[model samples]
Target: MAAELRLLLLLVCWTALASSRCEFPAIFNFGDSNSDTGGLSASFGEAVPPNGESFFHGPAGRFCDGRLVIDFIAQHSGLPYLNAYLDSVGSNFSHGANFATAGSTILRQNTTLFQSGFSPFSLDVQSWQFNQFKTRGGVAYGKGGVYRELLPKQQVFSKALYTFDIGQNDLTSGLFRNLSIDEVKAYIPDALAQFSDVVKGIYDQGGRSFWIHNTGPFGCLAYVLERLPVLASQIDQAGCATPFNELAQFFNEKLNQTVVRLRKHFPHAVFTYVDVYSVKYELISQAKKNGFGNPLRACCGHGGKYNYNMNLGCGGKKKVAGRQVLVGSSCADPWRYVNWDGVHYTQAGNKFVFDHIVDGKFSDPPRPLRLACHKHI
Candidate 1:
């Protein structure tokens, strides 16, 4: 009897220790181009240059020069490079899978007939990632076969964190395609409603934790600052594009409100709002401090009237009438430039954003559903 009691006590102690140190088993990510890792490249077979060239020395399909904010977060958390959930090329899921795609928006109406560059992931497509996991033996890698068997039986969904960074592309395509800033702002509430539906679907599927990001400052993008038509008739030469910024602020405020309501609806879910606007603004304001001289200068582009050619994306080979032209230009050093290809960032810039998220610099105002998953983490 004495020996049996000692064994029982030891077992109970071990269980407590293990639970205290339990780490998040997986990170399931969903967002737009800002968080995509070669998904669009795999889907399109086109190169976007100097893209992923800084760190990888070759195009790895990211929209930026090197790593993105997603990669940095994974790294800081001791996770490996996030695999594209669509990548049939690999079977590693030890870290997590990225479901984000370039040109994707949280809102469906954000899609327009006149402009079709936007390839935002629909909610249906986002759910497809779960189906992919089943094909991968119903388990994330590095967790062993025992966990695989347990995954289906246990509440494995509770041990994972879902990181979402998106919604910028919606406004981008809207404004550039000729919609006025005020026009786009008016559609934001409806767009957010659809976004909430997608989140609710995840909730029904047992997703209790969410890290969501709002849109960045669109008026400050190198592409907008340089190529945007000068509305000198409205705003003067200060170059801030006041009308455009006003719309961005309005969208961000509504997004915060949505997050708050989501928290209340699902008391068990933890929703964290990533303040991308403030993070990006901080970097742009301190560009000189970060060794980036001009935050609005695109690192990859030709020296045309607006420092860009519509025919050439960052990594594409410029051509005119079936004849190749070397019109695309690369920066001397991408590290010194924040904007990678007029719309994205350098690897360094992404790192800064990641640090802020992990540090919890802007998780305030308490969105109702956002606090659920945090208790376990």
Candidate 2:
């Protein structure tokens, strides 16, 4: 009788300890500028002030006025803010690290879609870097061996959350190259295949929990609205470019299908396909209710209908009416606008999306984001 009682106590204690363990002790993120904390800034010294003026008070390498969605996720999970994989100074790997870089694409060859040249850090390249990180016992190879800590301890990597928010550049680059809509659609399969390969690679390396975000409503971006005159008539009553939104919707639909296929392939893996488009579109569709006064305009940039001047770029200086002025002038009230500098979201906008994404319905596996950290526990 005493032996059985002791056994019961032991089992109860073990279960309690397992439940009490910190939820999602670590997180590994991969994507482009949308979630880049500082990789692009560390590499090229871009994203300078007033880029991060709103909240960070200085450019922290985020392509926004403040935090990215990843930052919010980290905060909610009780993990420390992620350090960019390339940042050399003041980096902490106890939680995990971010491998995202501005301009990263799903396909390596997609770089040719741009006239400036190719991006060296494709999703495949990021995957390779991740492999290197594992081989070196958590030490990152490039950017002066920025991360030196023995991270994602062999056991931690299996329980960590792996998040991905890429492929926007792939489609955008095709559009910039003037590819027909059908041609651009044709690229979806290849992009999804590469995405699958990336996830498989991570799975092979012990990662099992995933939080993936689909591309948002790119057509609603101030930059796209300014550049695509043909889409002018497609603007709806709410001021969103309908045709471009349709493109985004199509891409998201295909992406969701791909996620379904991946689920079948990795039956045991937890794949959370976050509906970024729906959340972002909701904000746009009900901007007034969200406290946003100008959902269709960018908070920065100059010399265009949407205040997005491609030639001068955001924060660039140019002669304006005799006096030299910053072409991409920041607005006095960033919170009132949804788009920032034509391409990215304002800090306020990102926060709204983060709130909805964590509400459970947006996540494919239908788990609350806060609970996702404890999923494998």
* Model 2 lDDT tens row, 52-166: 8898888788878888899999998888889988886788766888999887888875333145333568899889887876767543432243343535566778888899998
Worst 10 residues of 1 by lDDT: 364-373
- Which candidate achieves the best TM-score against the true structure? 2
Q: Rate the local accuracy (lDDT) of all candidates.
A: 0.69, 0.79
Query: At residue 118, what lDDT does model 2 achieve?
Result: 34
- What TM-score does prediction 2 earn? 0.87
For model 1 the local lDDT of residue 365 reads 29
Clashes of 1: 11
Off by over 4 Å in 2: 1-22, 110-114, 138-150, 319-325, 373-377
**Model 1 agreement with the true structure over 1-377: per-residue lDDT tens digits:** 99667555644554444434435566778888788886777776635566678887787778888999888767755677787766656536555677777777766644533368777465446656664564454535346665543233235566677787777776776787688777788788877887888788778777777888888877777567665655776442334556666677788889899988998898888778868788877788777876676777778876654355555757556568999865666788878877778778878888877766554545542222213244322
Best by lDDT: 2
